[model samples]
Target: MDATIEDPRLSTSVEVVFAKQHMPDLRGQVTLRAMAVSVVLGIVFCFVGMRIQLTTGLVPALNMPASVLCFFLLKSLVRLLQKGGFAVLPFTRQENMFLLTCVITCLNLAITGGFATALTGMTSTVAKTLADDPDPRDIVDNVPTGKWILFFFLIGMAGVLSNVPFNQVMIIDYKLLFPTGTVVGQLVNSFHTPEGAYVAKMQVMTIFKAFFGSFSWSIFQWFYTSGNGCGFQSFPSFGLGLYKRRFYFDFSATYIGLGMICPHIVNFGLLFGAIVSWGFLYPFLESKRGQWYETDSPSSLSGLNGYKVFISVALIVTDGLINFITLVTSAAINFYQIRQERDSSELTNYINKLHPSLNYDDRKRIEVFLANRIPVSGPVAGYIACAAISTVAIPAMFSQIKFYHVAMLYMAIPVVGFCNTYATGLTDWSVTPTYAKFVIFVLAAWIGRPGAVVASLLASGITMASLHVSSQAMQDLKSGYMTLTLPRAMVTGQLFGVALSSVVGPCIFLAFQNSTKPGAPVGSKQSNYPCPYAALYRAIGIIGMGGVKELPKYCIELCVISVCVTVAIDTAVLISQKRGWSIHSYIPSMTVIALPFFTGPFFAIDMCVGALLLLLWRRMEAGSAQLLSSSVAAGMICGEGLFTLPSVLLNMFKVLPPMCMKFLPGGQEVEVVDSFLNNSGASRA
Candidate 1:
């Protein structure tokens, strides 16, 4: 008997490997209830995902939790309807997974389009600050609202269109192991068995408990504590503070969850980077550049922090370039090997080989079923139509960009999508920003124009959005593959999601914009949202367009040195791996190396704590460590993440009275002193 023909009843356990052989009837996989549930949840999560990104600079992949949530909700709804003697088929596993994927994909689209646009405006603010003649007005004032809207719309469309080809390449041909997708696949399959259902229920309950617990804690921490002395911070002295800063922990559940999911090497890498920047280099820089370092103002801290971010960017870029080389070389070798196998193998020569037992009609039916099982061209037409619309509409909508530039963007979509997909496959970090920067850099170098900054922003926005969508799409396809879901159903669900998010995301962003004081600078007191990612992207855009001249000389030097050190370390790891050294397995990831610096020491500290705790747990009880990590850690993440949306809404509506406690009066005093000094400096100038 073929291994693929195993009966489900005989199979005692559910596993992702089973998906390869377990082909189910695809006709009823996508039901009306599933689509309706998906649409409603997709819209809800779009707002939730956008709010989460805007608030915390993190977007929790909600597919797993949402899947469990949908299962329970739908089951309850069915039971209620059945009480009235109405016949309704319980949702199949495929329908449930499809619904969750739609919701998660839509949520991601919201974050990609809405959040990217918000970041663009925020980046413009940073650009003005860097200008010789700084402007006090909001950076978004210069760009027309219609142009911004149209730009976001095009980006969303591009992401949806490009995702199809990228998904086929990454999920089908390359067979990248999307870890999150695999986990989700396993989770959805668990609903089939009684024991699995019980486990799933527990997981759902754990998430709810953790979510409300964390949510309540967040409210108390923010409202009652006045947002002071909640997290550990460094001592104020320059000498001690440098070392102490690395120990700063925010006590966030989000970071703890991140640590639980991420590899130990990643956690160590983050800690190592934090130590290098805050413990050693920052102090050294302070001594060497006293005038630049000695400042009490919050803005000055941000300025000094830019050096650390620059170092991170340098390391990230260097690591990315090396990875790109390795990917290209490996791909060439793989292609050659595949070609050789195809030429030599008898199976490859036989195109229409069917079982001898099957009759002609049976063979034809099987062929048609297999062809429909995996969609090749139905989605292609939709993708092409979307691409065509974007190519034509973008230049017309945004006059700053020319037809040729838009054409160039269209040309680069496949390249960027492939690179990002491959990179994410390897590191689970989409170097979208880095690739965007490279795109902008090449374009700026070629154009050599004054509007280079604007061009860079626009190009980066489009590239990032497409890459974001492609990455998510590939991940979704992986989940579908693992769950034995129909490829066409997954594609259809994504299209519906993209369409919904395209509208929901922009509306949410526009609401925020309208609420902001008309003339107030973005990231100021009057503006409610602080966009950290936007700041990072803005810095990249400026550097891409204007080169090192846009940054301080010292920053340039730091960036160069950082890149050199990163390359050396990576090379050592590569050599060690080639020699099959066991110790080499622990080499840090570039994504982790740059995370602490970008997110701040506080975030790193929490993650480190979680990683260490998990390490200890594994040592104590190896068998249960996996279970504890997945359930408890995931609950913590969902709890904190879901709670933030309501928290933001409450704050937005002023449901809670303002509360302040001066736990650190000296910090306030220092702020006043900094304000006075800044005023004096301005007057003198």
Candidate 2:
């Protein structure tokens, strides 16, 4: 890497390579086109995604967060291409189309049936417990719309606060208007000619817009009233029918019910946090950590890849089982519905109960039976359970086990969430309304949940890693587009990102889990479920079966191997790419893809493979272009990071008094945190 030659005559290979990398004359129309292409592609994909959502029962996020993702990835690719040239941006339209189509299909399947994915792991566990019991299948079918709405509304309220912190962090990275700082001292270059709008018409449109926007989401829920099932369903029990509605529980969902949703950048931010905290700082915390920071800028923190892989393997395998369970759960429900339909008597009974003219054949009795027979449960703190489980597991796994517990902690929140929230529920991890009573089950079977934790960790880590890598790669991609150093930029990018996630980690704990739920104000949907875990315990009190008090050897062995895979995959990835790429990347993905294939099909694998291919293509580029590609990938992780950013910042508002001046006269002119990325900008620029 040392470019200076002792003698002018001693022209080294390093010097030659360095000169080629700094190509400046290539900038011109091509760069503009790349920018334009990125924007155009973003809009195109957005509309395509919207159309798909409308045309099919499938939503894009089922396979991928296609809408925002399209924008981020395309932008990253276009810039990478422009910097590295057209050849650097490889496109396999055949594979991409195939992948897209597959994703769409998977989206349909997932919406229709992919319950056992990364999001549904813990949730499915609870459902299974309920199903296994002889209790009526009422809870899932009879929740009130108001209650469902309230649960989500509270979750939304808890999450939206992250927006501010997230946006601030994002603004620091994206260089929104520019790739750096805000433009200042604008001269009157172009005159608007003081154009004025029709005041009366403007006011009316604004009023109408406000009204429609406020009620739009509510109105949209009408379509789902019929058993079309898009999170929460209402079944009329008494005179109506047994209402079995779902509450909101999208594993990858970053949206609040508010008009706004979490953007892709936040996903990148979360990734940024993981890379810095785990990938970067972790090694320093390790014996081999010197490789991460001891040498120089652009230091490859590839060492942490093992930690990621190790954790991921455990999660991926368990998750696959969880996904299979989801398929079975959905199939069971569908089959049960079909069986009910075949029974003329059952059909007649159901119809009569729904009849407007239910003759006095015991209408009061029917109402009473409906009231007590079925209780539709709302979204539970199952995902929170995964997070909490990770929180507990962190110290144990890392300190006692002496491998990489932090990685385990970080990975489990999302990965476990992905699995347990699914439908069928992993055999290892169970979910049932009755299981909700087993809050103490965790204390009993902490290790059993490691599989669950791995799933959650994957959810969190992959989300983070994908986002961080993509974003950093994107930034490095600018040929003359940026002047930052690749290694420096990578680290700096992570700093701003982790700063956002620091709060997200805990917010998920407090909000969705709502630690202060019982303390919530009167009438607040936030429950006063005094020791709901007691209920879980009481529900499972028969065998004391909630979490694993005694997991089978096969299950324990599987978890042990899974943990090994997690570390192995992370290590392989970290150490894999010496010249171009190392062994780590493909191994972890292989382990994941391989896990659930035998049990059932993961149609969404199509999209992921495509993404992997894209990642590979960028990885081969290996320089500026690689930087760009990784940046987009990192976007996924950052999205999660952005989730808690606002709360993190808001919590600091008290310390940042006279806040008005942050924007005023001589406020501290802040630069992008990635300034460390600049080979020369850390000082003057």
Give per-residue CA lDDT, model 1, range 1-685, as digits (tens): 1212334344444443343443445556767777777766675566555654654355545666677777766666667778979887765677776777778777776776535433443345545433433333223344555655556666766665666655644553344567777677777777756777776777667766766776676565555432433222222223434434545555677677767766777777878877776667767765655555443333331356557557766777688777666665665665465446545535313222223342332222233323545455654576567667767777675544567787778777866676666656645656565566676667655655555555555666777777787777777766776666777777777766766666666666655544443354444322334454565554554565554343433777778887887788778887888798876678886756765565456556667788988989899998667654655666676566555455546657856526543323366777987799799999999
In model 1, what lDDT does residue 243 have? 36
Q: What global local distance difference test value does model 1 have? A: 0.61
Q: Write the per-residue lDDT of candidate 2 for residues 309-415, one digit (tens) a residue.
A: 22333454344444345445664564466446445444335445435353332232232222222112211242344334444443442222212333443333233
* Per-candidate local distance difference test: 0.61, 0.28
Which model scores highest in lDDT?
1
